[model samples]
Target: MTAVEPAGLAAFLAEHPPFEALGPEALDEIAHDAHVERFDDAALIHDGFKEPTDEVFVVVAGQVAVLWNDSRQASSDPDDILGPGDVFGFRAMLTGRSLGPRAVACGAATVARIPASLAGPAFATRSGARFLVETMVPDRRATDVPSYSSVDDLIEREPLLVDPDTTVGEVARWMTDRGVPAVVDLGGGRFGLITDAVLRARVLVDGRSASTPAREIMDTTAPVVHLDDTAAEALMLLLERDAEFLLVTDRAGVLRGVVCPRDFAISPITVGVSLHEQLRRATSIEELATFAGRVPPMLGDLLSRGLGAGRVIAVYSGFLDTIIRRAIGLVFARHPELSVDAFTWLSLGSNGRREAVLSSDVDSAVAFDDAVDAETVPAYRAAFAEVSGVLATAGLSADGHGTTAQAAMFSRTNADWRAAARQWLAAPADHNGAMMTSLLVDGRPIHGDPGLPAVSRVFNDLREHPGTMRLLLRESLAYRAKLRSAWFPARRQETFDIKTHGLLPVVNVARWAALSVGSAVLPTTERLRAASGSAMLPADSAATLIEVFDVLQRLRLRYQIRQYGAGEQPTDVVTLKWLSPLDRSVIAQAVREISAVQRRMDNVSNYVAVEEWASPGRA
Candidate 1:
C-alpha cells in the first residue's frame, strides 16, 4: 500500500472549487500525485496528435489559451483568457480519445498536470473528479456564458451567417420565420448579414430581384460578439461598428448562436396593469408598496434587455404615471369629494423622463380647476394632499420639501400653471431662474388633461429670453465634474463615482441644450436630437452625450440590482468601488468629455468656477 504525501499541493487544490468540495483524504491523495508543468505563450500543452494525458491541468498562474484546432485557423483573445484555479485539458482523457484539440498558454504559465492513471480511475469513482469534469467541460463551450451580463455591458454578438448562394427571397423568408430579423452569409466560416428591414426597404420597396444572392445586398461587417463578451463589450462593438445584428461565435470563430436587436428589445410600460393588479390584490398600502417594489426588478431586467436607456426611463415613468392615476382612482372610489376631472398630474426631473431609479422620490403636482373659489380650492388642495400621502404609503416618497405634488403651486388651474410658468421665465436670469427653469423644462404632464400645449408655451416664453438661457447655461457651468482623491496611497484601486462624475456632467450639459431650445422633452436622447435641430448643443457634444448617458445609466441600473439583491434599494449616491474596470475607464472618459463641455459653457455663461471634485483616487 502506498502512503499519500500531500502538503503544498493539497493547500492549493483545497482553495479551488470541486477539488475544494472533495473530502480531505481524497484531495490529499490527488494533490500529492499531481504533476507540475509550465509552458510559454502559444505553446501547445496538449494536442490531438498525442495520446491523452490522464490528468486535468489546473491553472496556477498566468493564462491558458485553449485552441480548437492545431492549424491555427482561428483563435481566442486574451480577454477570454482563464487563470489560476481554473481547470482545463481533460476532455480527451474523459472520452478516451487518442486525439483532441490543441492547448496553448496565453503566456508563460504554470499548471498542475494530474496524470490520467490516477485521475481516470478516481474520476470514475470520486464525486470531486466527476464535478470537475462536468463543470470545466461545460465552461469550455463559449455559449455557456451570457454575451453581456448587465445593461451597461456593451452588446456584442457575431453576424448572422448563411450561404452566399442563398436567395434574397429565401433569406428574407428565413429571417421572418426565425424572428431574428437578420441572417449572415456563411460559406467557410466568415460571413455577411442581411437584415429584415433592409430586405423590405431595399428589395421589396426598391423592386430588386427576389432571385438575387444575399451576398449582393448583405452587410459585410455586421456586429459580432465573442461567447465571453460582456454586455459593455457588446455595446462598444455596436457603437463602434454601427451595426445592429450581433453574431455569437465560439473561440474557433464557428457560429454558436446569435443575438439581434429584438433579443435585447425592451417592452414599453404595458406592464403597469399587471402591477396594478398586484397592487389591488394587496390588502394594505404597505403590501401594495411591497408589490410596487417589484417594479424596479422588472425595470432592471428590461433595461438589461437592450431597451434604449431613454425608453427605459419612459417605461418606468409610464408605470409611475399608472400608479399615480390608479391611486387617484382608489381615492375617488373611497372618497367621492376627491373626484375632479380638471386636474393634471405632472412629474418633474427624472420622473419626467420615466427613468426613475428603484429608490426614487415621486416629484409631482396637481393643477386644479380654475373656476373654484378660495374656499373650494382649500378643500381640493386637502384632497390632493391626501392622495399624495396615499402614494407615500405605497413606497413612493412624497416631496416632503413641498416642491412636488405636496405643493399647492403644483396643484393649480391651467391659468395658474401658466402664470407660474411666466413667473419662472420672467424671474431674474440667475440661479433662481436657472432652478425654476430646470424643473419646468423637465415638467411633463404625466396624467390628466390634454393641456400640454399650454404648458409647452412656457418653454416658448423662455426661448425669447436669451438672457435666461445664458443664465441657465452659466448655472450649469458652475460645477466641475467630480474626480477621485489624488492623495490616496498606492495599492488601493482608483475609481470614480460614475453617477456624480460621469452622469451629472452629461445631465447638466443636456439640460443646457434642451433649455437653450426650450425643448420640454425630458429625455436626454430626445432633447439631444431636438437640440441638434436648433444648434443648442454642439453636434459633437450631442453624440458624445448620448453615449455617455447610455453607459452611465447601464452601470447605475446594474449597481442598483446588486444593491437590491443585497436587501438594499438603489440610490444615486454611488461609491467608486462598485464599478467594473471597463466601466471605470468609460466613466473617466465621460467625465473628461463633460468637463470640456463645461469649459465651453464657461465661455457662454461667463462662470469660471464649478463644483470641485477629487481626482481619480486610489480605491
Candidate 2:
C-alpha cells in the first residue's frame, strides 16, 4: 500500500462498522496491509476456483452482488447485496473453505481488501467480537431470554371465572375453594377483574352486604395484557395504570388469568410491592421506616441484575413516595384535628421529577388551603414536622436549603404559594429566585389535591413573559465553566461532581426548553420529548440529550451503589479512579453534548431581549 493509500483506507474504515471497535493503532496496522481493487459491472471480484480465499472484502463504494451456484438450480439473482460499511466473505475465510459465492460489482465500485490474518485477530478482541456477533450472526439461543421473561411463566394456576350477577358471598366462597387470589368476571361479552384486596377494601371495609352483586365491586377498567406479553410490559402497565391486578387475555380476548404485583415480586426491584403493602398496613412511623430501609438493598439488587439506571431510580423513588405518604398518614392519624384535604404535600427537585437516586435529599413543601384559620396553623405545622422527622428516619435527609416543611418557607398556604410564584416570576434573577423558580417549576404533588391546574396557569403566565424566559435561558447556560473543566482529566483528577457537571446541564436545558414551550412536564426525559414535539428543540438533539442524560444518570448511580456497598457515605463527587475508560469516554461525550445544547440556546437571538436584566454582570 502507498503512504497516502493507507490513510485513505483508514479514513474509509472509520466510517464503517466492526472497525469502530478497534483503536487507532490497530486500524493503522490493518490499513498498512490493505489494498484497494476496482471492479466493473458483471466482473467477478473473486472466484472460488481461481482466487485464494484469504481476504475479507469491505465495500468502499457502489455495491457488490453475491451469487451462489447449486446443483439443483442456478440463477442470475443475487443471494445478497453488500454496500458501504458492509462486510462480506468472512465466513468462508474464517472456516478455511473455498468461497461459496461469486462476488460481482453491480456497477463500477471500489473495494478494500484486508488479509484475514489481520482482520481475524482484530475481530477476536472483546469489543470487536461483540460487534461481529451483533452485526452478522443470528443466534437464536441468545434471544431466548428477554430482559423481562414472559408473563405466562408467572401463572401457576388456572384463572377462576365468575358471572357478574354472582352473590358476593358465593364469589368469595368460590375464590376460597379455587385457591386463587383473584377472579375474572365474564358477563355481557366484557371482562372485569376482582381481587381479594379490592374485595377487602371496598366490600368488607365499606360494610357492604354479603349478598351484593359482584359486578358492583369489579373493576371494569383493569388493565389487560396478552399472555404473550413480557413481564416488563406488564410491569409498565401496572405502573402506568396504577393497578394492582392486570387481567391476562388471549388473542381471542378470552381471559386467561390475572397478574398481580406479587407476580412481579420475583424480580429484585419488584420486591417493593410486598414492602409497599407492608407500609400501607403499618400503624406507626417506626414500622414505615423499617420498610423504607429495604429500598437500598433492593436498589443494589436491581443494579446487579443489570436493570437500567433510569428504571432503578424510578423504582426507588416510588418506594420513597410510598414511605412519605404513609408517614403523612401516620402523622394525620396522630393529630386527627388536621384535615387531609387542608393541604397538599409537594415533592421538589429530583424526587419531584421521579429521577432520584439513593443519595437524594428531601426537598418538599406544603400548600395548605386558605380556609384553615390561624388556630389550625400550629396543628398543621406540627403534623408536617412529625412527618418530616419520620422521612428523615426513613433515609431522606432534610434539605439544607430549607425547602422542606421543616422550614417556614416550605410550609405555606395556597395563597402564599401563588404570591411567592408571582414574586419569583417578576424578579427571577434575584437572590435564591433562580433556584426557587427551577425547583418550584418541577414541584409535583405527592399527597392530597395537586392543584396543578392553578399552578400550571402560573407557569403559562411565566412562559408568556419574555424577561422570565430570558433569565431562565441564561441560568440554564451558566454551566459553561463546569463543561470546560470536564474535558481535562487533571481538572477532575481526584473528584468529579456528576450532578453539577454531568446531570444539571441536561436537566437545566430540558427544563428551560420545556418551560419556554409552556409544558408543565417535570421529568427530564419527558420534558425533552415535549419540547421536541413543540418544536422548541429539534427531535434529534432531544433524543441525543436524553441518551446523554441516561449515560450520566447511570454513571452516577453505579458510583453511588459502590459507595453504599463499601459502607461509605454516598456523595455527588465521584472519584476518577473508580471509572473505566469507557465510562470516562461516555462522561466526556455527555458533557460535550450538554455544552453544545447550552451554546445553541445562547445563540438563539429570537428570544426576548434581556439587555436590561441579563447584562454581563448578571447571573
Candidate 3:
C-alpha cells in the first residue's frame, strides 16, 4: 500500500473537535490518509453521490458555499457561505452515508479532508459523540428535503377554497374549519381570493348578504408571482403591484401558488394601520406629542420592507403630517377663536420633499388669507407659536432658519407670500435670499391646501429675471464630489462626506431643474425623472441624474438598514470605512458618474462663482 500524506490532513484535524481530541500519533496517522484539494472560483468541491465518511474538511484559504444534492441545477455562491477555519463534509463523515448537500469553492482556495477510518473509535467515544452521530445521520434525507421554490414556500397555499356553486354558508364554514379568515373562489381563474378583512370591510361592514357569491368579494385581479422569485423580490413585487397576495403562476400562467404579506413580508402593514389609529385616538396635544418617538421605529420598518426611497418618504411624510395636523386641530380646538380655518400650512425642505429621515427638523410655514387684518394675525401667530413649541417638545428639532409655521416671516397670506418672493427676486443679490430660496424651493403643503398658484407665480418671475436662473443653477452646482486616490497605499488620507458628495448634488440639481421647468414634484428621484422633459436640464443629463439618484438612494437604504440594526439613526453621512470592497467599488463608480454629470452641468451654465476671500495669498 502507498504511504499516506500527513501534513494536509494534520492541519484539517487541528480545527475539528473530535479530531483534535485524538492523541498526536493517531492524528498523524489520520493526516497520512488525507486528501488536499484546491478549487478555483465556481469550481465544484464535491458531489452528492460521495459516500459518507468520517473525513472532516477544513477551509484553509478563501471561501466555500454549500448547495443541495442538485448542485448543477441549484447553486448559489455566498448563499451558503463558509469562511476560513469552518468545517465542511463533517455531517457526511459522521453519518456513514452519502454526503447531504453539495459544496463549491467561492474563490481560488485550498481545502484538506481526513478520512473517517482513521478515527472511527475516537468518534464513537467523543464527548459530543451524539452531535456527530446526529449530524452524520440526518433524520431527513437530502432528496426528501423541501425545495425553496413552492406555492407554500411563497404564500399561504392552502387558503380556504370554495366552489363557484358553494353556498355562502359553506364558504363561511370552510373558513371556520380551516381557521383561515379568508376564502378563495377557485371557480374563476383570475378573481378568487377573499380575505376575512375583506369580509369585514365589504360584507359585514357594508351589511352585504353572506349568501352572495364570493366573486362579489374576491379580488380576481390581484397580482401573482412565480415560484422561482426570491422572497426579497416577492416583497418588492407586493409593493409594486399594490396587492397583499401575489398569485403564484408558472411560466404558462398556470396557478401554482399564492404569496401574501405574511408569506414573505419582513414587516407588517398592521404596524402602519395601528400607528394611524393611535394618532386618531389621541385626544390631547400632549398625548399626540408623546407619540412622536414612535415614528422612527415605524419608518425603519417601512424602509426594511424594501419600499422605494420615494414611497418610503411619501408614506412617512403623510403620517408625520397627519400628526402635525392633529396637533394643530387639538390646539385650535382649545383656542376656538384662533381662526384655524383661515390659514394653510407648509412643510419646507426635506419634509416638503417627503425625504425627511428619522432625524429631520421641522421646516414649516403658515399662509393666511387676506380676510384677516394685522391685528387678528396676532392670535394666529400666538397659536402657531404655541403649536410649534409643542412640536419641538414632541422631538421635532427646530429648523435652522426658525421657519416653522410659527415664524412670522414665513407665515404670510398668498398676496404677501408672492410679494415677498418677487421682492427677493427683484432685490440685489444677497446671501439670505439665496439661502432661504434653497429651502423654500423644495417646500410643499403638508397640513393644509397647497397654495401652489402663489409659489408658481414667483418661480415664473424668477425665471424671467436675468442672472436669477444663473444664480439658481450656480447655487445648485456649488457642491462637488470629493474623491480620493485611496487605492494607492502611499496616497495621502482623505475623506469626503457622501451626503454632500453623493446625495446633495442630485438634490440641488433636481431642485434647480424643477424650478426652471415649473415642475412641482418634491422628491429628488421624482423631480429628476420629471426634469427629463424640462428645457432647463439637458435631456441626457436628466436621464443620467435619474439613474444616479436611484443608485444613491439604494445605497442610502442599505446603509440605513445597517444603521437601524445597530440602533443608529439614518443619515447621508455614509462612512467609506464601513462598506465592503464590492460596495466601495460601486460607490466609487456612482460618485464618478455623478461628478461627470456635475462637470457637464458646469459646462452648460455659469450659475454661480466659487471665489474665496481669505488670507492675502488666497484673496
Candidate 4:
C-alpha cells in the first residue's frame, strides 16, 4: 500500500462527481486520508459478506466490475462498471446492509480508498450524498405533467364582441343572453373589454343610464397576449394586471378569443378562478382574512402536485396582490375621504419581486402626489395604518425592517421620496441605506397608480450614479457569508435557513445587476433576463443564476409547506434530514453555481474599475 500525493489526489477528485461538488477544504480532507492501491486482472477487490465495507473506492485509471452475489445472472453480467470518476461501496455502509456486491478489477486498475470517516463528511456536500442515493435508486426522477405549453391551446372559440355604437343596455342584454360575463369591443381598430364589474362600477354605481354607449364605459387598456404565448404568460398577464380578461391576438395582430382567469385555471392546485372570484366578492378585512388563510394550503397543494417553484411563487404573489387590493378597496369604501388616486401603494422586497414564499411578510411603502397637503398627510397615514392592520390580521406582518406603509418614514409624498432616495444613495453602504436600496430597487406599485412614476424616478436616479452601483454591489457581497464553503461540515442538530443562505444572495445579485443596467423590472428572473440582454452580465451567467434561483426557491417552498403541515410555524430554516438525497444534491450544485456567479461579478467589476482608472475619460 502506498499513500497518494494529496495534491494529485485532490486534482483527480476535483474532476469527478460528488467530489467535484466538494469545496477545496473537503477535497483536502479526502486527499489527506486517501490511499492508492493497484489490483491485477480478475482480482477480487472485495468479497461479498466477508470483506469490510468501511472504505469507499474511486476508480483512478482502469475499470472494475461490481457484481451482486445474490443473483448468479448479475455476477455474470455485473450490476455496474466503474471507470474514472466513479465511486462505489458506500451504499451498503450507509444503509447498514450486508455487503452483497463483490468488486473485481477488470484489468490492471488503480483505485483510491477513502475511509468511511472521511467519506461520511463528504455527504455533507449534498452532491456527494445525492450521488450515492441516485446510484442506489435510479428510478426516482421528478414527475412531469402534460401541461398546455401555449396560450393558443387554451383558446376555445371566438370572443363575444359588439360595435362601438352598441348601447350599454343592448350589450348587457347580449351578455345575459349569451351567458357570458364580458364582451370584447372591437371598434375603431381598438380592442377593449367590457366586464360586468366595469358596467356596475362605471355605469350603474356612477348613476349613468343603461342607454349610454358601452364603449364609453369599456376598459380600453386590457392586457393583450399573443396566440403563441405560453399559458404561463397569459396567466402572468391576467395576474399582474388584475384584469379579468386578456385579449388574445395572432402575430398578424388579428383578434383571437379572450382568455379569462378560468381559461388558465386547469391546475387544481392554483385554483385561480375560485380564489380571484372570492377576492373580488369579499367586502371586508375579515372576509379577506379568511381567503388569506387559504394561501398556505394552496402552496402546499401546488408543491405536492409538482408545480415549478417559479410558477408557484408567481401564482401565490398574484393571489396575495389581489387580496391586498381588495383589502384596500374595502378601506376606501369605509373611508371615502381618502382618495385612492392621490397615493400609490408599493409592495417592496419579495412581494415587489413577485417571488414571495408562504412565510413572507408585508414589505410595502406609499408614495403620494406632491399636491397632497400637510393636513391630508395624517389622513393618508391613518388610512395606510388601517390597511396595514387588516393585512396583519390576514397573516402578513409589517416588514421587520420597517419598510411597510404603516410607518411615516415609508409613507411619503413624491418629493419626499425623491429626497430620501438621494440621501440613501449618498450612503449606500450604511445599514439603513443598503436595506432601503434593496427594498426600493424592487418596489412595484400594487395599488392605485400602476405607473409608479415617483418610485421609478428614485430607482432611475440611483442607477445614474456609478457610486450607487458600487455600493449596491458591496451590499450584495455582504450576504456572501451565507454561502457554504465546500469544506464546511453539515450540521445534524440545526436546520439551514434557506431563505437567508439560499434565496436572498441570488436576489441581491440579480437586483444589483438589473439596477446597474437601469432595468426597473421587479421579479428576480426578469431582472436577470434584462441584465443579460443588455450585456451587463454574460447570458450564460444570467441563465445559470436563474436556474439556481429557481432551485433554491423550489426547495424553500417545499420545505415551508412540509413544516406548515406539521403544525409548526412555517419558517425559513429547513432540516437537511427532511430532504431527499437528490434534492440535497440539486441544492448543493445550485449554491456552488451562485457563488461562482458572484465571483464572476466581482472580477468583472474590478476589471471595469481598473479600466476606468487607466482611461478616466473613456465610457
Q: Residues 63-181, candidate 2: write the lDDT tens digits.
A: 99875443212577876788887777665565455534567889977888889887775553433433433333212111222333457776667888887788888888888888675
The true-structure Cα RMSD of candidate 3 reads 20.1
Ranking by TM-score: 4, 2, 3, 1
State the local distance difference test value for candidate 3: 0.63
lDDT of 1 at 315: 53
Top TM-score hit: 4
Error of 1 at 45 (Å): 58
lDDT of 3 by residue, 373-466 (tens): 8888878878888787777766677677677777777788878877777766765266366666777667776555555427435765555665
RMSD of each: 18.7, 23.8, 20.1, 24.8
Worst 10 residues of 2 by lDDT: 137-146
User: lDDT per model, in order?
Assistant: 0.60, 0.71, 0.63, 0.71
Off by over 4 Å in 1: 1-273, 276-287, 303-311, 429-431, 487-500, 533-536, 604-619
Q: Check candidate 4 and list the clashing pairs.
A: 23-486
lDDT of 1: 0.60
Going through the candidates in order, what is the number of backbone clashes in each?
Answer: 45, 0, 8, 1
Give me the overall lDDT of model 2: 0.71
lDDT of 3 at 585: 72
